[model samples]
Target: MKRYLFCEYKKTRRKYIFVMAVAITAVALCWGLYGKYNESALKSGWMMMLYQLPLLNTIFMPLLSIVVASRFAGIETSMMKQLCSVMPKQRLYDAKLIYSLSIILLSLLIQFVSVYIAGRCFGFSGRFPIELYALYFMFTIVPAVEIYVFQFSVSMLFKNQAVPFFIGAIGEFIGLFALFLPQYPWIRNSVIWGHYGALQFVGGDWDKVTRISTFYLMDINWVMFAVSILLCVAFYFIGRTLFVRKEV
Candidate 1:
């Protein structure tokens, strides 16, 4: 069972990494060639080069989650929950986390690098507040888990890659448009990247600007990450139970 799970998870992880690398690199190339339409920091009010990069996480991450989550479910369809029940709890949980985390981390890393490269090419304020970058690193972990938790949950519920992927797309669109509405500022509170202020880490609260740009959180990043982690764990176990208990 362990061997099978590892093989399947590894296969997906490999594909996820390869595809994301190519896609993000292409995105960086585009940024270097043509600014994000008129949204460039210079044209817009952004004083920073990094600001010129559209928040990729706002759109791409969820799309990736949906694509990968549906693929995860589609691939796992042949196996019943029994496979998980037979494995030790730790192994089962770890396998799932390793699979999801690899995807999350790789995508984040690629996006960060893409931004840096674009910044250098465009001469947008390539300067990021070191402290803000660090905080962005720390706080982003929660958003990553939130992405996976939803992916896994949605996959389990629909068991169709298209269903979850479509839902994710719709949600992404709505989430994007919602932030523009004055009445919907509260809705922005729930978005993962919505907390850009943390990215302003080096600037900190000493500067009012950091306070304005950082994503305000209802709870600390760690707490949010932990909660999402716990939920994913619970969802994995529940999925295993359902798979195992079913008459395969």
Candidate 2:
């Protein structure tokens, strides 16, 4: 397993996968932090950050996963026939899956640290809200896992990376719009891409006249969270089976 994982990294070491992941995270963070630090924003900066991040994550995380998965899948598809002759198909698939997930996990960690630094640097109000941040991390990572699994699966099955990328782009469009349907939570819950918005524990209510936003803790959708995990497991097994059974 270690050798295979290392081999997977070696295959893409020149591709600057980590660099791309970091760049995406940075862009999302910058976008979320944009806007004037007004009175209301200053008062509830931590919560504001939390509230706004999922909206950005809904679009950016899947995009990162799509690019990473497609790059890895492209690498595998080109060399799969030769690699299969000397290696077990399942191991190859597992190696790539594990490596790809590790990349995502690292990106998530970077995002967390970047947010924390931004909070400290900007002097956000209230305590650090470690518990809330923890919940945010869980909410973000779960949906991301599901998205990555589906993205990776499609990327692997179709040598044309465009198929999975187009699917991911469509999902992003739907998920971003689904955020406006908060009154109909089920609408967001219906799609894996929208789960980022669906599972968010922070919400913001803005007063149009005052031009101020109030951020508060919202109920976490535990049921949808659980469902996402189950779906991720299903996707993983289904993807692995297909890859293992495919004619190299």
Candidate 3:
């Protein structure tokens, strides 16, 4: 497994995955820095940056995951019957799942580093909340995995990348719109693409007239989180089954 993973990583080094990861990281960092500058006066610089991380993840990660999954599956899809005849299709499917997930994890790490640097540079005055950071990290990763599994299934099920890519593009727009209609929290939480906004670490009440905001640790939507986990498990088995039985 290690050898296979290593070879897969090497293959990705020659692909656009690394370049896309870097570009996403750079854009996210710039946006966070800009948010830090604008919200610094509100005395929630750290929270502002942290909040923005999830929002960025919500909006972009689906598209990114789709691309990674498509590329990873492309290896097998391109070869089709020849590759399946030699290796167990299940093994190949699982490896591609892991490969795509590793890319997602790399993207998450970049977002974390960007948030940490922004916090330090903006002089967020307090004992750093490592606990909050850890929780937020888990929150973001769980939904990301859920998204990856679904996208991976779609990518593998379809030989043409355009199909999955188009669906992902539409999902991206849906997620962006979901962020605005917070009154219907379930509306967003129910969709995998909107999970980042659903499982937020920090939330607040804002007075429109006074332009004042008070922040608090947002309650974990345990039900939604559990549903996401269930979806991941379901999709994994379903994808594996479909791929194994697929006529190459």
Report lDDT per candidate. Answer: 0.53, 0.88, 0.79
Best by TM-score: 2
TM-score of each prediction: 0.64, 0.97, 0.91
Kindly give the number of clashing pairs for every candidate. 16, 0, 0
Candidate 3, residue 103: the lDDT equals 73
lDDT of candidate 1 over 1-248, digit per residue (tens):
46846765565764555476457546644654464433334332222323323344454556666655666666556664655556654455356556655766776776666655645555544344455445465555555566566666667556456777777777777655653553654554555434332222221112465423322223333444555456556766675565444343
Against the hidden true structure, what lDDT does model 2 obtain? 0.88
lDDT (tens digit, per residue) of candidate 3 on 13-75: 778876786687677667556742445344775665566677778767886787788888787
Q: What is the C-alpha RMSD of each candidate to the true structure, in Å?
A: 6.6, 1.1, 2.1
Q: Please list the residue runs of candidate 3 whose C-alpha ends up more than 4 Å from where it truly belongs after superposition.
A: 35-42, 207-212
Q: Single out the weakest 10-residue window by summed lDDT for candidate 2.
A: 33-42
What's the TM for model 2? 0.97
- In candidate 2, list every pair of residues with a backbone clash: none
Residue 188, candidate 1: C-alpha displacement in angstroms: 2.4
Q: Mind giving the per-residue lDDT tens digits that candidate 2 earns over 1-248? A: 99999998898999998889989988888888777786667779988888888888897999999999998999866678999999898898889989989999989998899889888888787789898889889888899999999999888888888999999999988888899888887778898899999898887888999988887788778999999999999999999899888876
